[model samples]
Target: MGKGGEDYGKSEKVGFEFRDKIFPAWAKDVKECEENFQVSHEVGLSTSEVQKRLGIHGYNELEKHEGVSTLKLILDQFSDTLVRILLAAAIVSFVLAWLDGQEGGEMEITAFVEPLVIFLILIVNAIVGIWQESNAEKALEALKEIQSEHATVLRDGRKVRNLPAKELVPGDIVELRVGDKVPADMRVLSLVSSTLRVEQGSLTGESEAVSKTVRAVPEDTDIQGKKCMVFAGTTVVNGSCVCLVTQTGMKTEIGMVHSQIHEASQNEEDTPLKKKLNQFGELLTMIIGVVCALVWIINVKYFLTWEYVDGWPENFKFSFEKCTYYFEIAVALAVAAIPEGLPAVITTCLALGTRKMAQKNAIVRKLPSVETLGCTTVICSDKTGTLTTNQMAVSKLVAMGLRPGTLRSFNVEGTTYNPFDGKIEDWPVGQMDSNLQMIGKIAAVCNDAEVEKSENHYVASGMPTEAALKVLVEKMGFPGGVNSQSSSDHESILRIFPHPWISFYFSCIFFYKP
Candidate 1:
């Protein structure tokens, strides 16, 4: 116990901010990061060290905001201004009916009908809103479960273990392979393959897989330019790498963006449709109140002024009973003017529209979003095959030898991944040298992909770019079968180095040990 022991003791103290005290791990080289964090890239952290780091870094997960309870969501539905006004009207109506009964007059059943209807509408609307919100939250939770749950990590010298991603701490050496989601932000330490590729679509929205490198990039490199780093949530699409965990949980770059989203949602204003509906409700309420007041005043004046002839005349005698009757009539007029059923109808319609949108593969998170979409005038969209075909084929190929210029070039004709349908013509067969043949062999053997017959055509199961290359090899008069000799030899691919950001070419080393 010397300097190392003192550092460990200080790490255990309260109010120690690890991030503020150390240089950003992403900006540092792999060796520098390992030294600063006191971790071994080969053996990772010891069991005791992992526990101590967990205590200091918290869990390796995003901050989960507690979901709104069902009861609370239901109560929130009634908090709308229009709903509150209806509730107040209902209460007034019930009190008036009770006063009538206490005065010894015959209690009409119709006197309670409006209040009962209002109450029913309020309850139904609240139930629908609560159900929709709860289902959406549950679906989101299910998706999170289906993603990455456990990570393969090195611990306690040479032992490898599959631990929950949430339990992963910084400085852990994690292994990534094709189809595996990166569990945390990591710096590429070393790789078994010459090139490891990851699909950063979740973070960068790019359709192509990005290549990763062990070399440290510039300290001021932008997120997309950091070729040495692999972020959490992106999937490893090709090859494999052993990376040192630099950041985990909310400290990662993806986590920072997630935190920004949460903050923006907290400060979200009302949607356009919601704002318009509220303004309409306020205006309608004022208009109804004014109309009701005018009617009541005119009725009182008419009743007190003249006498009635038969049933057509309007004149009547002034009395307390007449005044009470006129007041009751005014209250009834105000209640009738309000469209009590309007809220129920609107809610039901919006809910139906939401269900329809979901059926069409478009999910509407909120009811008002349905109306908002209807009012939208300008819609922006990505131009990637959403409106057209993204079918790709090799239009031309130029092969060159190591000695000088072009050895032989050919024009290829194809329209998709269907390998059997394409052809190459005008080839200088006399000049089909060993270098050109080697290029074709490299294109075929270095790839870890296969094409299979699906009904009437061929479909590939790997990267589209690699699949296109395989088609090229087939059109070059080589055996184009899925189990062709070249493809069979692909099993001996020793390493692949893909240049995604720089040259878009892959260099490979092959070994055939039979």
Candidate 2:
């Protein structure tokens, strides 16, 4: 149905034309959306059509901007204003030394030592900066590999399992189960369970899982309120659903965010330490230039001769030997005034700071960024995963006994979702007393989370609180755990609503017998 309870038909534009249009998928009904994409509810796109769309839309993976080349990284090390000034000074010193040797009619090896030492210091600093930056980039790339690698797609009226996520294209049908990462941004078509929910905290920063539906919503609905759609990079937490892929690659919302972040990092400004060093270098160069000019003037006035020569156009003739001596002295003075070791010392200090941060599990991409972090006094961050562990497990349980005012407290053993690691402490010392047995049954029947063994470890696929409750039920040996039981058994015993979708402060499970 359309907005305001009106009937809606297929879009004016069909197929790939509507794919790149500024259209919102959540505003259209499932049938109309399928029609626009030229797909069917039962059978998905054919092999030929899937390949064609893949060529047009590209892969579902995010675009990786090209990294800095080795030559460019080395050149960038000398791009600092201070380093440029020092380079000019070193060239002048080398030329003066060469001229002095030419006047003496023999090459002097010791005169060229100053320039070589300055060049050596600068090279060492550049090497340290390049090594630290490359290591940090590798660490960041490893962290970005948390997305799903494979997905289940529907093609040619049959299910294709374990298909790589990068091969998915627009109009493809994808089946998502609990604990599965969403492969692409897709519109919900239908669900096989009573309720379907997704954990979008990585995308939306919401701690609660969002309930999904197949019904169309208003066009002006915000991203968080779009119940008819699921985005890429999110995870399915509760039930299974089949969705139609609408966007892939850089067209998806998460891809857009990655593009923005990449652009920001490329255009990052210089750190405070770099700015201060540039200003200091400029000021020092000005001072050295003034001093060199003064020395030359004093030498010209007192030491050089002003004898007249016949071949010269001008009347005065200066002593060539005395002039060359003063020029050499001026170059030496300027080179001495500038500290060639300062740049290397600064680079070494920043490198040391980066190493300390790495030891503490904090990666530093740039050397100057270490100082930037040291200047930080307050940090505002999302509390869900940054400040606390995102996983939840039961720690303690309290139940009321059959007597009027009797209460018993039992401590759950482990802090993880694994059920076999620890045992409950301070039990009632019987074959599961009446009160504890009822509590265990209620915990198992009411929870919607599924905790099962994948390989060697157990993983959970629902709300953390509910997952903790399911683990508790398993430890108490409830019938068939949670996921092993049939849906018919749950429907018969759980007549009233047991799980609360919105609030979780309290839960009620009703058991009925006819």
Candidate 3:
């Protein structure tokens, strides 16, 4: 839709024409933005070209809204009052066991054996449920992690491997491969007739892999020039490269706007679902508490002649030794009133929820996350193929230098090359190339991205913004030297981590002096 909801798709002058007409004043150069609010720029594509070439979108732009996380359901089921009471009963039973043991040696075990075994069984079941839930959380955290495995770059006149991608100052020739992740943004200088499917889900908010090509771009472009340039974090769907490292880490396109992620709500949203689930869980706990209280009260009467099985011996009952029966039945009542089986049931419910969610694509990490899902007033979720339609489409195309061509098709063709329209048949392919070739080569050669075809779609291993550059190159034709394509996990390395941030650091590349 246009600014006013008009279908600019039908208009002939909306793409390049509209962009050329509205070049904003502040978008002129690097100095325009605040010095502290650092901006990223690629040489081949201008700011306007970049902006016009790409659209501002958030990830998860395409997805069906599912109601709640499985964890939430689990938490809702976790509030069984019987479970709570049972836990207390278990503790009392353990104390009673110790009391018995103190009165006699191993023979005293009989005094506590009945309740002790009951509580232990109940607690064991609860533990198993909790263990299962914990396992679910662990399973969700296994997403692929990207790391800096020394980049292959041509420094004086030979190919050399270095530990630092940051040392690759602009103008350095870097070698790329199918399985390599883009360590930094670069301009492609050379390549085999390779193909790389770059995923720009981070930048344009489009998650699907975009085809790339080596073509020139507009002087005022904003997003296209960097399309071929691979950044850090994203995976390369395919291809190999020898690019000129243009930008690194924080200075790359994805890095600058990384902060632009919509700030999460300070307070969580109180959804009806959460409120109802919470209320239900709480009510269930209360109901169980009430039921347990009544059951214990009724069952107390059934314990007649306790001396037969326990308590004072039947034969010595009321013996005239003047020895008072030492039974503070009230405390016993309190401890016995707690249902020992509730906690186990509640925990089992939670574990089930956790398991269910894992199947639906929602990964719950923390123990509280199970309950938190039911009470998630605010969720700061990643906007990848999640909230949005993971299947990204070329909704609108704004050609910068091409001859007033209208790219109105909305089909999601996943090929790594630009589709030909009847208009393009009449128009020379030269138009697409002249405007995109250099931009493509620069972005591709300068990139630190690796594209690989996974089980299904193409994935990039570098920066998403750089993947955008590569995808754009292939999409606009000019496909000669640059390609975004590659292979997958042929080598598996195992490392033990003392902390999670270490893994984050490995995936999160940095730009600094080597």
Candidate 2 C-alpha lDDT tens digits along 406-496: 8777888987789987878865544777777777766776665778887777878777888888888777765555544443254443322
What lDDT does candidate 2 reach at residue 387?
60
Error of 3 at 64 (Å): 34
- Scored by TM-score, the top model is 2
lDDT of 3 by residue, 403-475 (tens): 5744322122343322221122222354545444454555455555445566655664544444544554455
Error of 1 at 29 (Å): 2.8
Q: What are the C-alpha RMSDs, in order, of all predicted structures? A: 9.6, 7.2, 18.1
Report every candidate's CA lDDT: 0.71, 0.77, 0.44
Better of 1 and 3 by lDDT: 1
Q: Using alpha carbons, what is the TM-score of model 3?
A: 0.41
Per-residue lDDT over 143-180 for candidate 1, one digit per residue giving the tens place of the 0 to 100 score:
34323678889897775657889988887889887667
Error at 210, model 3, angstroms: 4.5
Question: Residue 105: error of model 1 in Å?
Answer: 6.9
Measured against the true structure, the TM-scores of the candidates, in listed sequence, are 0.69, 0.73, 0.41
Identify the candidate with maximal lDDT: 2
